[model samples]
Structure formats: structure tokens, C-alpha cells
Target: MVRRLSIWAVGLVIAACAQAPAVPPQASAQETPIAEYGFGVLADLAGTRWRGEPGEADKEHGQPADYSEWDWDLGGSVLVNRHVLEDGSYGGVTYVQLSRKPGVLDYVYITSANFRTSGTMTLNADGSWTAEEDVKGLPHILKVRSTGRRHADGTMSGVSEFLGDDGEWTPGHSFTYSQTTAPLPDLVPSGSPPE
Candidate 1:
């Protein structure tokens, strides 16, 4: 499966390049997102800190990753997620997003300490993002599918669902992750300019 995904990703890059327009002498920060091996739009998540607050969970049926801290690195394209239940031990995922058609639809590819998975996330008409994960692994007891919607207060709420072998889904614990940093303007160099 990984092999097939790799080949498909390569093909996507080639197709996007063939369809991409010429870059002007200078491109602004608002320039069209570029998909170089699927790392373009994912760049937006950089330099952000997410603090995930736990909600309610079923101790018997639901298995939620209790995240107390999540820090996304701008330089490394990595997210270090600290688990609340298991202190000192944590998991990290390197986020990668590839545009299948440059500006049409992009897919998310995440690589973590143990596994790599791919999926899609679409922005809803209501200004929220609904993300779907390709694989959610915990094995037999329950096969979970990840789905989440972004909230307006820079908070993302997500829950796991158990996809029945017969194609049904049961929702699990829902949690919210909020951005820790308030949006601040860039620092003025020194004797720059008077606003």
C-alpha cells in the first residue's frame, strides 16, 4: 500500500508541475500554493501551538489519545504530541499535504514514529474543516476512523468513530484543540518605518 501511495504521489507531483504556471520575478506571501512533493499547504500549520483539552470518553469502549500538549515546529514540519495518560512518553507526526491538482483538492500524508497514513480534509462552506483519515489503527477491539471539524475560535474538535465491518460508524470521545498563541504582528527590525 505504501508503495502504491508513493507512486501515486510522484505522479501527482509530475501532473501538478505540468499544470503549474510560471512564477513571476517575485512571489508574495499570498502567492498560489505550490505542491512540491506535497508540503505546500501543510506549511500553514507551522509555528502553531495546540493545547488539546480532553472531553468525555468511554473507558470501556473508547480509546482516546489523551493529548496534553502539541507543538508544531515550523522548521522541522513536525508535531510533538505529549500524552496526558502516559507521562514522559509521546508521539510525533510529520505532516505533509499534497495538491493533486495544484489548487483543486489536497490530501494529507502524515508520518509518525510508528506508522504513515494518508487522508483528505475539506473546508466546509460554513468555514469549518472536516478531516477524514485513511487509517486509524488500534487493532481488533475497534477499528477507528478519524474525523474532525475545525471550530471558529481557532479550536479543532475531533472524535474517533468505530466503523463496523458492515459499514456503520459509532462516534467516540470528542475533544477540542485550541491554538495557544494569539496572532501577533511581526517584530519591527530596528529603525524601520513609522506606521
Candidate 2:
């Protein structure tokens, strides 16, 4: 029975691998030209949250935890910047800052983390764009990909992925945002201003 089960598992794994997406060929390093663009940052203030199975082995062994009851109140902002390449494709870096609000959960306190993600953003003539980022960190790495339409009002809507620590890339999160009309404040210089 055990031998049969192992065969079944192996068959399932092969079937799943056949369903993965094919990677596109990269542009030649020497042929690709680098282009850059400056973009203003915007915040999506509707409030974000994340919930998942607890990491504790004891908790999982004792009883099944209700994941629906576990969640954290968090907020995040995305700084979008883009550059065009000689291959006619575009790429850019998006700096994302995420913070969890205090006293939002009963059992856990979420700490603040920032991710500086750099990826390729391809703009299609059809008013649609796709952005992909490969994020590397200690213990694990993630590949996040997003596809959205650029509205006439300068807003964007799309779905995202939160590839987990196992190195397997999969679609996991979704989000939407509109451009803000308020003017952004100027940045302070490194040196202190004259008092």
C-alpha cells in the first residue's frame, strides 16, 4: 500500500509541473537599452490584512486552528517607477513599505517590514501593463507578478502573488488602487535645515 501511495504522489507532482507557465526569453544584454521614468508615490489607505495558519507545531498538533479567526490589520504603500529598455520592453523598481497597526490582534503583534522590489514592467499598446518582481531575502525568496489596466484617470487595478517561503511561485494576493489628487510633500535634504 505504501509503494502504491508513493507512485500516486509522484504522478501528481509531475502533472502539476506540466501546468506551470513558460518563461519568456530574455532580451540580449548588449542590445537592451535602459530607460527611466519618475513617478509619484501613492498610498492605498483602505487597510490591508493577512491571515494564515499558525507556525507553531504544538498548536497544529493539539487541535485544528480556525484560520478565519486569525488576521492582522496592516497598511502598505507602493512607490512605482519605470524605465524602458532598448528591446522595447520596460522595467522598474517598486519600493513597498508595510506596517501592522498595534492592538489590532489578540495573539500576535505584527512587525514592520520593508521590501525594495525591482522587476520588469511591460507596457502594452492596449492600455494594459504587467509587472513582475523576484524578491530575495534570508530563509526564502518570492516572485510577485501583477497585471492591470491603466485607466484614463491615471489609476491601475490588478492582482498580485505572494509566493511563499517554499520557493514555489503561485498567485496569492490581490489589490486595487486609484491615483490621488493631493500634492505630495517635498523630501527633506540629508543635512539639517538652518534653524
Candidate 3:
């Protein structure tokens, strides 16, 4: 009687297995469609505040050193970047998301300077990202482009240029950022620069 019960249980298990649907091997988390499309390319930047001293051009332009922090929002569907000068003189917040086009990202930057930019960022084969933006509310510039690269030593650097009246690209912002724990200046809300 025990052998018959064991056979019955085995038959039930076989029936259940035969009825189960076949599922192909699933991709790993990193190989998911969103990740493969480069949605999380900047994920490593989250979780740390970075500091960068003002470049010579920044000093010439009266800009101060800055701190930047990045984080994932909306369950990792968006990347948010916040930056503030060490002196509390300037700051900006940026929101980035995967563009409709694969391997590209769309971003909007709102500055404390009463200007904002809409841009697209793309990753280069060399592990760098380039951003091209159209400026608004700032009469002196029309468009801007920048490239940022992360170094093996965990430092980040970027070079930017602005479109000039001559249709030429002139030097713009530059910075080399490293992880920081120092206090950062306050960033007044976007569209509401301090008096």
C-alpha cells in the first residue's frame, strides 16, 4: 500500500511538471532591457557628494568651488543631480532620464542664475558622456556642450564650451570632482534665486 501511494505521488508530480509552461532563461539584472539601454550608466555616481575646486576659467568668471550630489528617484527611473557652490553663490539641479532613443539621455537643468537648459547626454565608447544643451534666459549664450569622464582613480572631470556670437565654441565650465564629505552651500529653489 505504501509503494502504491509513493507511485501515485510521483505520477502527480510528473503531471504537474508536464503542465507547467516553459520559460526561457531570464537575463541578469544588469542585462535587463533598461540597463542594456544605458539607463543606469550613471548609477555609480549616486550615494556620494563630490567636490571640485574652481578651474582658472571659473575663477576668472567669479565662480566658486562646488559640490555635487546625485541620486536615483522614482524607483531608479530618473537620475537627479544637485550642485551648489562652496560659497553659496550659485547652484543648479539637473534631472536625467533615458531618452526615447536608445543610448541617449534627456536632461533639464535649472540654475540659481535664473536660466535653464534642455539637453541630451550620450555615452561615448571611451566611457565618457557628452552633453549638448540649448540655453534659455541667458542672453550671452545660445548653446553649450560638455564632456565628462570618470577616471580610474574615481575622479570625475569635465570640459565645456559655449556657442559664441561668431558661431564659434568658446571655453566654458570645467571641473575635476572627487568624493567629499564637506558641507555644501545652500541651493535656493529653482526659478527662485535669492534676493
Q: Which candidate is the best by TM-score?
A: 3
The residue-by-residue lDDT of candidate 3 on 153-191, one tens digit each, is 766667667785568877666666777887667855444
| lDDT of residue 86 for candidate 3 | 67
Selected candidate, larger TM-score, 1 vs 2: 1
Question: Cα deviation of 195 in candidate 2 (Å)?
Answer: 40
Candidate 3 segments whose C-alpha is farther than 4 A from its true place: 1-35, 188-195
Residue-level lDDT of model 2, residues 9-88, one tens digit each, is 11111111111122223643233212112111112212221111211432333311111111112322232222111121
RMSD value for candidate 1: 14.9
Error of 1 at 66 (Å): 4.8
Which candidate leads in lDDT?
Answer: 3
TM-score of 1: 0.48
TM-score of 2: 0.34
Q: What is the clash tally of candidate 1?
A: 0
Better of 2 and 3 by lDDT: 3
lDDT of 1 by residue, 2-41 (tens): 1111211221221122222233446542443333234333
Clashing pairs in 1: none
| Superior candidate under TM-score, 2 versus 3 | 3
